[model samples]
Target: MWGSDTDVLNLALAATVAATVAAAGWLAVALARARRAHRRSVDERGWLLERERESAARTAVDEERARIARELHDIVSHKVSLMVVQANAAREVLDAMPQEAEKAMAAVESAGRDTMTELRHLLGLLAPAQDGSEPAPEEAAQLTPQPSLSRLSSLIDRFAFAGLPVEVRISGEPRPLPTGIDTTAYRIVQEALNNALKYGGGRPTEVTVRYADHSLRVEVLNSGPSVLRGDAPAPPQPDGERPDGAGRGLLGLRERVAVYGGDLDARRRLGGGYRVRARIPLERA
Candidate 1:
């Protein structure tokens, strides 16, 4: 009886030990499965984040490329348009007025050469530079032009010829400014007048230029009916939509002003018309 009792006790103890081992094995497998699932979730989230960053970078590059394309169109198209108009008008006089035709042809040729040079420059901006290559001196010279404060009058006259009456009112004694400031100011005024001529359609334009202590102010006003004021308001497109090729002119103007740390405001006047105001600090000069 005592021996039978001992054998039964041993069997019972062995069965209990085997049951504990089986439970531990099942628990370990569940834990490993949970860990694998968590790791997979983390990897998926990381992949999504990387994709979002790449998308944003691509969007930025696209916007920059479009802006550059607009600038090239503005500079090249304006010059070519003027040249075409001059050439056509000159052709009308070739038979009737030989001397006038000769003079007109000379002007046309000069404009053509300038247009070609500027177009080359616009294309050069797109080309990839060689590895640390030094630019030829002559090429550098050609790229640089004498853009100074003294060119203000000529710029004004060009707009006046384009049919926008520009009134240049200069205040304070004229002093030499730094090249960067001078060129920026000149371009600001140039773009303002161009906007007036292109959009205003022969309206009276007012240009006020003032130079004070370490500051320059330029204001261009055109009393033309604003697009918003008109009965037909141009419908705004959704994001990523581009305007007609010609409509990017103002966009180009805005970008040009921004490069000099200047602010340009283009909006409709309360009474009637459009106004462009730009303020640039001259201290940098």
Candidate 2:
């Protein structure tokens, strides 16, 4: 009977040892699973960070593209306006002196044709790509032109037609204004008129162009009920030169005029309106 009891205890001890081993094996498997899960979580975090970086890069590329387009517009439009103005001046000369007018007309035709060609080239650069390929720098080099003093009137007329009432008042004999000066003047007036129309809330606006001995002046004024009193949302700014909704437009104009070493002033009229004034030196035709 004592031997039997001893045998039974031995069997029980063996069973207990086996059970303990099985539980330890299960604990090892659980630890392995937790480690795998931790690794997967780390990988997922890395993937998310990579995606965020790519998104930011894409946004930066888009912003850079817009900035380049604006610069090209300023350079091209300013030059083209000058050419058109000169062509008109030539036509005036041709009318006054028939023999000289014939020669002047020929020159004007040649200039107009050349300007049109250049404009087409620049337009191609301004337009977004149809294909995924990026534009080459050579395209920009080929498209740029050196425009001078002759294209102011046509530029002003374009604004007038666009909705701003623009008028030119020449005080001195209309000699050639410098290229930079002419471009600055045209852009300043153009931007100001654009601002007036956009932020003026359908109010009447006036643009006055003045040619003086040493300087060219452009002024744009729009009158309406005070913007401050209205329930209208703040005007959108293209740039932040003014508090009005026309900020961007005014800012762009300000930068443009500054390039030619020009001065611009913008303010709200006391009675209730907006005023923009730009002055450029006539030194480099």
Which candidate comes out best when scored by TM-score?
A: 1
TM-score of predicted model 1? 0.56
Flag regions of model 1 displaced more than 4 Å.
1-67, 91-98, 128-132, 146-150, 160-165, 173-184, 198-205, 222-247, 255-262, 267-274, 281-285
Model 1, 128-158: lDDT tens digits are 3666565678887787364456887876765
Point out where model 2 deviates above 4 Å: 1-68, 72-119, 123-164, 227-234, 237-246
Candidate 1 residue pairs that clash:
none
Per-residue lDDT tens digits for candidate 2, residues 53-145, read 999999988866754565455544433444454455566766577776565455546546655666666566567678857668876566545
Q: Model 2, residue 101: displacement in angstroms? A: 39
RMSD in Å for all candidates: 8.3, 12.9
TM-score to true structure, per model: 0.56, 0.45
